[model samples]
Target: MKHLSGKLFISITAYCAISFSSQELAAQSDVLDINEIGNVDISTLLEDTKTFNTIGMGIALSIAECHGKDICEPTVDEGEIGQLIETLDQRIEGVVSRQQNSEEELTPIITAYVDTKEKYADYLERLSEISKPEPELPQEEFVEEDLFTDEDALTEDEYSAFDDFEEDLEDDEDLDEFEDEYDLE
Candidate 1:
């Protein structure tokens, strides 16, 4: 029984370690590959255009949300944005070059794609501007001033009366008993 339990524990530990290491490796490899741009075919480009259109619509919605509630923060970082644009440009160039080499009469389609991509880039810029956090105004430090000088202070009798009231409140046995009873330490 002890041997079986020991083997089970070791297996579980090894499985958990392997899972965690794989997840870490996946996270580290989450960068976009620009070289893959050259390998994109027309079918893949068409599919990617649909995705780009969806992304554009999402950006429009984000703009609307920003205008409506002023809280639409950007989901993509600047570095990632730059990488995406670079990859997109590379893909378009690759497609155009390949078409030119093949003597394919479908250059218009590639031109249209480039135009659409340019518009998407413009939208991305607008989204970036819209999602930027507003600059905060500098806060002023508060310095309280003495409202009344020594010559304009309260009279000795009035001060004594206030002190007496404070002392009386502090010495109230009922208040102390109530605080202790309520556990109001």
Candidate 2:
């Protein structure tokens, strides 16, 4: 276990050494040495859009195939870095072109959708404003009270009228029949 850990440590150390020392990575990253940090221009580094991408955060595979504690050297040449940058630039250009093409294709469809929505909104507004007659309230038939209508007045006195009503009741045979049936003598 101890030997394995030591081998792992040595491999990692070698990887770091190669990554920091390689002229290929140095040209792109501007980070030539671990100790000479004061030489790195911070403003320039930040301005370079592709600076940090090439700073060798890649997985360290043992390039030289050293078994244990042997010191390893970087083999990444300038040509390899150039090819890698070219490939990335081509891929980015292709992606940007595809995005622009898709935008052009969709613009007309989006515009048509917006126009249809606006037309529907205008139609809805016109439908809302369409006038209809207000429902006619049932004309409350107000018959005029006849203020000058003639009515017959009693010629006889009030007491005499009551006596006449009682005499008529006694002469009615149906009233007598009803009284007999109800046992009212």
Candidate 3:
């Protein structure tokens, strides 16, 4: 009967421990600020993750070292823990506020940049229209000036050569007559 009572007590204690641990985990998870952490840059995110991991490991080691000692007592000072949590909350809020301010400050500069870009594009379009080449109309047919007037005379030898060339042309017969005489057809 005593052994059975011991087993029952151990079982109840184990159940209570499990329930308490689960509740603690749930409470810790509720306090996590997803939005505050999400806004952090990649470099800072990595650094913070590394720092937190180191701190968590140190705490875990401290707890392990205190095993079987009075230092491993389950009792916690709620006032001190609450103060630390509040300080951390304030820091997170400050970071979030700073991020919001930076975004607000940049808004006008971004607007001005966009406006300047649009105006530059409009100016370029106007310049292109003004600089465009005009279409060419059909040019007038060129009328060459008379290089030699009637006052210019041909020499006698030049005239005779011209007459001889004309007479030779008139004396030449058609190719059909020449072919008929030769019986080439």
Candidate 4:
């Protein structure tokens, strides 16, 4: 009787221990982990277009990788910097449109855009210090040929042909037969 009671107690204890550990693990999974949060400070990087694209960012990455620590900014010219920002702005707007304006999706893209803009801005400021005015090359004399002179240029007859072609395209007998594919008003 004493041995049986001891075995029963041990079995109960073991089950309870297993249950507690599993419950603890489940609880931990439900909580947010601080380490997994995106906390990388990108404020120092300029939010410009050049750093936004893969190629431009690749050049920037090479510099960063070569440097042991984070540097303050890039050293690109002011015009180049502005171009970069404009390009980045266009890209961000396009992405936002495609995502249908969802805040969750826009958040990371916006952050990256801003960071690139800031980095390029910094690079522009630095460039102003030792930058020289680029020497202007002699302008080439304009030798113009009219676009209308091109062999593919549409003539009055060609334009009329397009109308005929469009009429032919609209004359699809199959479209009317497939009315069941759509509901009529």
Candidate achieving the largest lDDT:
1
Q: What is every candidate's alpha-carbon RMSD to the true fold?
A: 14.8, 35.4, 34.7, 28.2
TM-scores of the candidates in the order shown:
0.45, 0.23, 0.24, 0.32
User: What is the number of backbone collisions in each predicted candidate, taken in the order shown?
Assistant: 0, 0, 0, 14
lDDT of model number 3:
0.44
Candidate whose TM-score is highest: 1
Name the regions of candidate 3 deviating beyond 4 angstroms.
Answer: 1-42, 70-87, 99-185
lDDT tens digits, residue span 3-25, model 2: 77976775676566556544454
User: Model-by-model lDDT, in order?
Assistant: 0.57, 0.44, 0.44, 0.48
Off by over 4 Å in 4: 1-76, 98-104, 131-185
Q: Candidate 1 residues 82-162, lDDT tens each?
A: 554665576577666677767655565566557657866776677666646765765543443775798989999989999
Q: After superposition, how far is residue 15 of candidate 2 from its true place, in Å?
A: 7.9
Q: Which lDDT tens digits does candidate 3 get at residues 87-117?
A: 3454345444555766533333233323433
Candidate 1 vs candidate 3, TM-score winner: 1
Query: Tens digit of lDDT per residue, candidate 4, span 23-113?
Result: 5433432331223112222231222222243333432432333233333232233565576567556555655554573433455656676
